[model samples]
Target: MSAEFLAELATLTDPAGILTGAATDGYLLDQRRRFAGRALAVARPRDTAEVAAMLALCHRHRVAVVPQGGNTSLCGGATPDSSGQALLLSLERFHGIDDIDADNNTITVAAGATLASVQAAARSAGRLFPADWAAAASCQIGGALATNAGGINVLRYGNMRNLVLGLEVVLADGTIWNGLRGLRKDNTGYDLKQLFVGSEGTLGIITRAVLRLYPAPTAHATALVPVAGPQAALELLHELQAAAGDRITSFELISAPCMALLAQHFPALPQPFAPIPDWLVLIELADAGEDSALQDKLAEVLFAQGLDEALLAQHASQSRAFWELRESIPEAQRLEGVSIKHDISVPLSAIPDFIEQCGRALLAAYPTAQIIAFGHLGDGNLHYNIFLPDHSAGVYAEEEHINAIIYREVAERRGSFSAEHGIGQLKRGLMQHYRSPVELALMRQIKQALDPHNLMNPGKFLPD
Candidate 1:
């Protein structure tokens, strides 16, 4: 990067506009610390105008820009490459809730606004912005939409892509595309906003979004049910969904290893059941009415299905406690050690077979490996992670093998290699192998159309 360019970039905003040296350290490192890269400078623009000006300068100079949000990407999506050539464009300053249209059931917020903040804003208005994840407090709205993040509530409210009604994006050429319409029934022409939602910032920079909101649930019923295996778990899910219908907000599957890890790491947390079941399902129901018979419905379904082992949360505290266990699984896994993680999804009916077969194949190849399986069961997504006995030795030696086995099986079952987590740098290779030629070409064509110079998030989502 030239001094003249840096000087011009600095003039885009006030003091502290561009960061370097020690100041750039945090922006360069991702949440997972998997991809560390150098940046020409960390550009923190104050608002959309500054964002446009900075991006325009980068475009003029042909400098690659990586649009980063909270930098909470698991796949190192937000992290720049180690080439020291790309400009790290940070949206941290664009944190503002512009409007909350209760009548339209939509809230428009700046892209840098954290998910938790948006949720709080919705709650303040007696509405629910339901796209939630463990990193809600830190993950930004731009990152969420860019990755189309799917969380616990995905089965009910859908992913960030589904929740978005409109978007304000800054194109590669720094042209502002203000499609920030809050209307739900716009069918005039092409839905261009969809292009940037899950493009992982490669196509354009997501500056703002109009997100759909739902009526605040007045009551919640949560439960932890132990089952024999995935088959029994799926059967129970069928029974519950049959009984409770759309009231089922969350249905997560937890393997025994996950529960044990929780027990080991979080000793203070109560072990809900005696002799932790090898397979437990965390179920939750939510409704707008305070007098919802969710508990009674759950009990009836469990009893009728002969699922004898169950623990229903009797109060709000217990409900929160039950959810705390589900939320702690990822952190516990991180503390345990490095592992080959897969955020893949299969059909609801194929989950049992996929799990059993995949487990058998993985164990056959690497006998000492531990499969710490868990995820949103309601949506058929599984965090099918593998922890080797020697975590250090296996990640390098067997990661490819493990991913090959798992993803191949997923493909066989007509499943996706990258489910909730977008294909950033981590799964870009998989995108090449698994994605068909036509689909890949279409994606590349779109990337080429919007970002002809390939300056926006230079090397992510799309293949090299």
Candidate 2:
């Protein structure tokens, strides 16, 4: 069966498209290297037609299809299972920026187009594609939309779901749904494009997208301010938002431990804080006018709020330097070693309480655990990670107990266990625990309706 499938797959695309044996090795491992799996072959479809045909063949063969984008899924959503019976559908070859409508403020791009490429294209067209993060250079548009990614700009521009105008998806049985309308207002029944967004490719494969763009902001202001604590940070955020309004672009919370990690790993990077405060907030503001005016407005707000020690960026280089520290955190943590990572979000008001309580609970359980809590404070999402003394895979042995303590706090405060990251294999079990039975049933029904054979990225997003 495998031989026949590979033969037909080889004919669908070029010989270079179908990968097997060692060639498929790279696609099997996830970004975190936490989940490793096997695939019968990695199929790189060049266009929507080829993707549909490949998926149609898989449907006919009753083979599971694991759709993958830039392979930057931190939750192992793209990696296949150990069965070696699934076909890994790679969208790498479908990368293309089809069109950029300056008037409409929309960009039509192929699924495999990287976030960085889209941003550059938008910039060239005098527009802005605001969906951005650390993996912008490599994470593809399809995966970003699939996961409904939220980045630094989410506070102002919204998540990937909000930015998407329409999508082109290839269903399980060769059905192509082209709803790619660049309309801002559509009073249509059932916004179907949304179902696939953040569905983690369980329903279908995203082929192309019509994404919303914004006017390019000429003015920019960035500042790294030291706060007394989470409460102080929250107060400052409110004060800045009140003064700057929608112009405030990013407000990231950085912990002292993160600062220490940066100093240890990235010693060459500028360390602004003398003793490193207990907490720091990296704030950025942008507008259409001049940078001096925006910088003055930001500086005035910080001064009014009594934060005199704010390290405000004076130039483009300084702004880049400030952003570099915030972006290099994940890599620094990786270099530090293995840890139990959680991407959780609560209400903006509950952040301080959540951090304080969760930290206390975690410490009580694991006395030696080092809490690395930092993320988008403006949106209440924190990449709260725990580095045990072991600093190895063995620390994962306590993941269940640690997760129970943290997730319980999150639940109590009406927060989410999974914030920006989608529930791949890693957090699928938590769904049954966190989500209500009715919600899970509805998801199952949708999956059943879309892919009755369970061939579209099986054992992901939804539990059996």
Candidate 3:
């Protein structure tokens, strides 16, 4: 970024000292503080029009602009490199509930609306906005859409890509793409809105969206079932899916190590099982119907099939307690310190085998490594992470060797190296190793076509 361009942007955004010391703040650092870079400046746009103007100016001057929604991206998507050429564009100020299309079963929201707020607004209107994330409280809608995020409810409602019906986006050259029609069915030339959904700010910045809604489910049935291993898990998943089918809102796989870690760190959480089983599958069933007998019947089936050796959490209060343990796995691991993480997905049929084989392979390679596995199993996604056996090795390592060990196995299984958490700066190398030559070249072509100057979040999610 040149001095002349910096002066123009500072004037346009009207930020507090953006031309000087603002870049020294935490805004430029990635989550986990693993990647930090010098941004030319951090520009906060108050609304869509200003965002458009900012992008337009950057385009004219050939300055690189990195579109950031909440600065809460887990994979370093929001951070710039050391070049200081990229301007971090934050849309957090453009927040407000635009309109509630209650009759249309849609909600129009600004890109900066937090996911938690959007969900709350839908709840107020007696509708369901099922998209959620652990970072829902902080992550903005545009970031969620940019990554096409999938969370706990993906088993029933699908990912963010399925939840969004329409979007209002600004193109690479600052041209508006107003395709925000809240219709369920519209047969047009191209479903152009989708092109920007998971483009990760490489293609364009999503400024607004029309989100799909469903009837709010008032009753829930949640449980934690202790099962043996992969085969048992497959059997249990089939049995539960057969019983509740779509009502099986979430079927998450939890490893014994996960529980042990929780017990070790989160001591307040009481153990639900006598002896920790090899794995546990936390299940939740919710319906828009009034009947609350789902939990009773679910507990009965687990007992009868011997699918679950032990059952935890029957009532809503108990259900919440059970969920707290599952949700705390990440936090507990964080408390333990940094670890190697792989957000991977294999076929649903291959989940148990994948887990068992992956575990065995890693144990064979790095015997002292502690494996932590848990995730949304219904969709075949797993948060398969590894912790160093000793405290000294937690954050730093000759980790490239271990990364190779895991990613190579994932590729062998024909699985996605990145299931939900995207290919932010950390996984760019892995993408090259996993993605084919033609596919990568095509992505480069798309980036070149849309962002010709390489000035829109370049050097991210793509090989440099």
Candidate 4:
């Protein structure tokens, strides 16, 4: 039966489309190299028709299908199970931009197109695709939309979910749903495209998307300010918003540990701070006029608030240097070695309390733990990670206990355990613990209604 399935799958696309044995090894391993699995074969479908045909064949054969885009999922969302009975579907072949409507300010692209590619296409057309992050160069549109990814710009443009106007998806049973409408206002009925936006490929495979774009910003201003603490950071955020309005695009919070990590691992990178302040806020503003005016407006606000130590960018290179410090943090952490990471969000007002209380609790439990807390404070999401005495995978033995302390604090503050990152296999178990019964029930019912056979990305997003 396995041989028969592979033979049939090869017929759906060219011989190069099917990968088996060691050729499928690369696709099996995840981004962080934490999770690895086995697959009967890796299927590279060239277009929506091929994807639909492959899914139809799998449906008939009762074979499991795990959809993967770019293989950059941080939570092992795209990895196949260990059973070796599943077919891994790679969307790499479905590349390129379909269309870019400058008048409508929208770009239609194949799901496999990298976020960077889409951004370039939009820029060439004199528009902006605001969904961005460190992984923009390699992370594909389908995975970004599937996870509803959030980035620094999320404070202004919102998440990938907000940028998407419509989607073209291939359902579990190989039915193509063409709902790629580019209208800004559509109040006809339930928005079906949303179901697949953050579904993590459990309900269907996102083949294409019509994403909303924005006017390119003509002016940009960036600055890095040392704050007393999270409370000071919060106060500064509001003050800047009041002065700059929606032009304030990013407001990132960086802990002292992050600066130390950068200094230790990325020594060549500019460390503008002296003696490493306990906290720092990197603020950016973008608008339609000249950058000098925007820069002056930002400087006036900071000086008025008595933030004399703020380092404002004088040119484009200086601005890039400020952002590089923020963007290079994850790599610095990776170089530092293994650590238990959490992507969480709470009410903006509760951030200061959450950081203080959560840090205190974690320290009490593990005295040697080095807490590295930082992220998009403007959007209430923080990539709070902890490094233990044992800088190895063995540290994961304490992950559950550590997560309990932090998640409990988040729960108490009405925050979320999973923020921008989707609940892939890594956090699926937490769903039962953190989510209410009714909410879980609704998700299960939706999964049942859509992929009744449970063949679509089996053992992910939803719990057993």
State the C-alpha lDDT per candidate: 0.90, 0.95, 0.83, 0.95
Which residue pairs show collisions in model 3?
none
TM-score against native, each model: 0.98, 0.99, 0.95, 0.99
Tell me how candidate 2 scores on lDDT: 0.95
Off by over 4 Å in 2: none
- Stronger candidate by TM-score (1 vs 4): 4
The reply for model 1, stretches above 4 Å from the true place, is: none
- For model 2, how does the per-residue alpha-carbon lDDT over 428-464 read when each residue is reduced to its tens digit? 9899889999999998999989999999998888877
| Better model by lDDT: candidate 3 vs candidate 4 | 4
Clashing pairs in 4: none
Per-residue C-alpha lDDT of model 1 across residues 34-134, encoded as one tens digit per residue: 78999999999988999999889999999999989998999989999999898999999889999999999999999999999999999999999998889
Error of 2 at 217 (Å): 0.1
Question: Number of clashes in model 3?
Answer: 0
Off by over 4 Å in 4: none
lDDT of 4 by residue, 1-464 (tens): 99999888889999999999999999999998988999999999999999999999999999999999988898999999899999999999899799999999999999999999999999999999998899999999999999999999999999999999999999988999999999999999999999898899999999999999999999999999999999999999998889889999999999999999999999999999788999999999999999999999999999998999999999999999999999999999999999999999999999999999999999999999999999999999999999998678888999999999999999999899989989889999999988999999999999999999999998889888
Q: Model 4 has how many clashing residue pairs?
A: 0
RMSD of each: 1.1, 0.7, 1.8, 0.7
Scanning candidate 3 in windows of ten residues, the lowest lDDT window is 15-24
Sort by lDDT, best first.
2, 4, 1, 3
Q: For candidate 4, what is the TM-score? A: 0.99
